[model samples]
Target: MHIAYFPELALLFADIRFPQDQSPNNASIHLTWRPPHGEAKELDVPLLPDTTSLERIEVTMHSSPTSAYKMGETHNKWLSTCLGYDTVLAYLGENERPVLMSTHQKSNQPQIQQGGGWLSSITSKLPTSLGTIISGDTEPDDKITFADCAPFLVVNEASLHDVSRRLPESEEMDISKFRPNIIVSGAESCWEEDYWSELQTSSGVKLHLVQNCVRCVSLNIDYATGKPGEGESGKVLKKLQSDRRVDKGSKYSPVFGRYAFLGKGDEGKSLAVGDEVTITKRNAERTTFDWPGISSTPLPTAS
Candidate 1:
């Protein structure tokens, strides 16, 4: 589950970054945390050593239920103290979870199964134009991290600007509230991304637009105070409800951005900042967002 489940997490500022000079496989990544009312601290969590044993735990996501490896007690204790609860940090070790097929995927498309060692052999036979063949040890095209729905959530800067324009004079919307993985600019108009079916970056990485991401109450949380906002700030979701409830699949929650997954041949590729994104495919009509797990039931209306 996302930290949004515990609204207090909004107040926790964590700076997690990878070392620029080292390959990700060998980089020493660290997390610096600034709690609402405490000394800023750094969490030194090393990669799971081969000798360290991890407990397999089950975690439920919006799209499906999957398993993950629970981290050690020290890290869990630190996070639990920050959140004022007993919290366990779960790590999605490689191959621990498979990306579940979504309704947005075409029925006729080939379904990538988990632990399919066949991908390595198939990838080697493909033309080099498709990109380097990824080894089976690395994440397969069908695998995902602990993402809520899709591997990526893409938002248009123009659409965010439009939302800011609609806010009260004293209140401006921030991209952090939406929690998008990619922020795209250069759109001809606001919400133009709704019609985009596929996008390719200048670097050749491609993403297939899936469902429209549904808005949740977490958007109203004030990151500064770690509590629900006041006045107009708290009503961002309500404001969007007027015109953003366009996705019939998730009727109560307004849609803001598009959920996406990496295109088949673009896996194991890196997308740098400022990469020019081009729409490679367009939907003739706006996609009707559908996810039976969450959309099939009614959601609580945002206050």
Candidate 2:
């Protein structure tokens, strides 16, 4: 998916027009569909899908020296027609937004991935789309695109295996199902992140284990089938609720991943795969949920 101006979205989400009955943007998305050989019809009254699904699909993006950052008026009209609903697209102009702080580090104008046709050669650079940072800080902080919440989600490979062993349908549990940004493989046991406080890489890049990540219906979507699976009582989610219900606030909303942020003074350092990470800090006192039985223990098998 491509990135859009964050401010424009913030405005749209807060727009009063969306609250009106005729405003046309409903809580549920309406899809116009046609069967293989039967009459065309619409789906349910309220689809209740997440907003990410609405971002227009791009078959392939070719770099153009002059591709407009703001989509033209015709393009906006075309999207409305294609989506079969009244939709509006807007662009956040350069210099329209200010630098902001996240739970950690800073979220400024968008920075982006830089690379060629392959993965191994890729790097990152600040995006020119959002103009220079307006903050007084001499050096710029990290650039972030729009996000639903915090920036990074860390996964322990051992944790996935642990969850599978507890579920009846293990085949459906793939690493991709959780969608983690970083996956560490050598943890001593599963669910250890519930107590991890901070970590550093061999190169001294440090990150703080901020808080628990709450699971939502979004996780139920099967990447393999593109269909959200739900038993009569939601078997997969039930299994999570039964054992992974560490968050007492809402035991129904089980958590499986840890949200992390860049530790202070570690902004310039980057985390690469296989960086020989070490647990720079650990906390034994449980906050939200204890990892089954792991408590106050130093991160084991940390590389």
Candidate 3:
């Protein structure tokens, strides 16, 4: 379920907060929304296994492939009514979807071997390789829920500020539109994250920076109206396409943020706002953004 294909989904707001006394043994999410010309509705959906038979569905993406459990008729009916169309909610259980192999330190074996000494030692300290990091002969414990590509998408505040400066004065760009899982500030220049290979937080959580995140038409969506904007807001992607297509992989889409995954021993670690981020490793050259499952296509140069 992506806003680019189903714009109406933007109208639905999910309250992911759990009750203070909620336990993993009994978990659920509460959803509240009011359809157009309809009364407000709310539902507390149980996360535990139910008697309703679920359909297993194959979910394919540019980065990797996975499976999801599609909810039965009752849950689907409630969600469909809110969206004003027939739809189904899918759930990807823990460890169901592995993080992309390209994002793992083990995937850069050739570079580590060539560099030797320090470079190899640093990565050696990281988690052991998880086979292909997807469906392969071995199943991986390091997994993500339902992110598009990587487990985390990190954006630099300075880079976002640069983007705002490029936009027309009448147009405004919000960081929420980019949907980054983490935002780092105090960067000296815009787009400096392109060279970052790894980051460590003040609390010792480390992230292996993988690839540049590709932009899409969803950037032009106006959350207020749940529709694509017709003004400068609609041209946000076009504006980024003018210069942000630096990655050789996925060249057709503009790059704004870096996709990343947690490093060794950082699983289940907690991160909060205002945490200081330190760039632990940086590439001498910008990453070309290559992945095993993704195909790249060239795009016309901006006029």
Candidate 4:
């Protein structure tokens, strides 16, 4: 319903792996804050301090910011970012600065060509008759925190179970692809970006609603189980497009808005949970709302 907090530090990490053989004991993910509602920090470390105890650090997701627009699989998975548990433990102790890593794979992570890079190649696959493809604008400062991004928003236990049953036989739910930042309870029909657009933090940072996020087939891939197949999440979105809302051609309709950037965060620049928000209809003002499946022309705005 509201913006929670502005990220003091954002970290982008790649090539993450956790051994399935053991339960996380020394190092794990946890949210910690000072007493009486103090600073919030995610610790990937252990509580007890010992010579071999693990330390914690926050990670900034790379795919969402860099390659999400293009649907490149090379760096899409979380495993691409996180390292072995023991290695993460060692890194925390050694460095206090924000960290970013690319898995040692010889192959390059698939990159999205915004304006100049991969746009032409991606559009080449789509039928030329489909019209022009417009690249959505990117706002650098409008980054979200890990707390805001969670998969539960798109699917939960009950929804997952029902989805599995309703899905065609042999079909699996690749629920991880949506990669929701906030798993909200009782959200309205509007896209999350529309909601985010109307949001303002206590710090007076106006959340800028830049563009409606167009999703790709990646949602068809499951993050946790790493299963590949079309299932619940994609089915639901496809259904939403076909039966009730926009036609299939409206995939890039900007159902959700992207945060363009954040304002200043001073001592008073703090965003908390449960703040007031005003809703602004999405694409409502546009004379023509069309989804350019894929096109070579650069988007109207660059910033």
Model 2, TM vs. native = 0.52
Q: Compared with the true structure, what per-residue lDDT tens digits does model 1 show for residues 153-179?
A: 788888988899888887679888888
Question: Each candidate's lDDT (Cα)?
Answer: 0.66, 0.45, 0.67, 0.28
What TM-score, computed on C-alpha atoms, does each candidate reach?
A: 0.80, 0.52, 0.78, 0.35
Cand. 3 TM to true fold? 0.78
Predicted candidate 3 versus true structure: per-residue lDDT over 144-180, tens digit per residue: 5576766677888788887888778866587878887
Clashes of each: 0, 1, 0, 21
**Top model number, TM-score:** 1
Which residue pairs clash in candidate 3?
A: none
How should the candidates be ordered by TM-score, best one leading? 1, 3, 2, 4
Better of 2 and 3 by TM-score: 3
User: Candidate 4 lDDT, tens digit per residue, 1-303?
Assistant: 111111110122122223475333443334232222333333333322243423233443422222111112322222123321212222222222211211011123222211211100010111111111111122222223232321012212223333345566776443333343322223333332332332332334333333333344444433332233344544554543442232222433223223232223322233333332333222232112221222122234546
Off by over 4 Å in 3: 34-40, 48-53, 98-101, 104-143, 291-294, 297-303
The top-ranked prediction according to lDDT is 3
Candidate 4 ranges with C-alpha deviation above 4 Å? 1-177, 182-188, 191-197, 230-237, 240-257, 264-268, 280-303
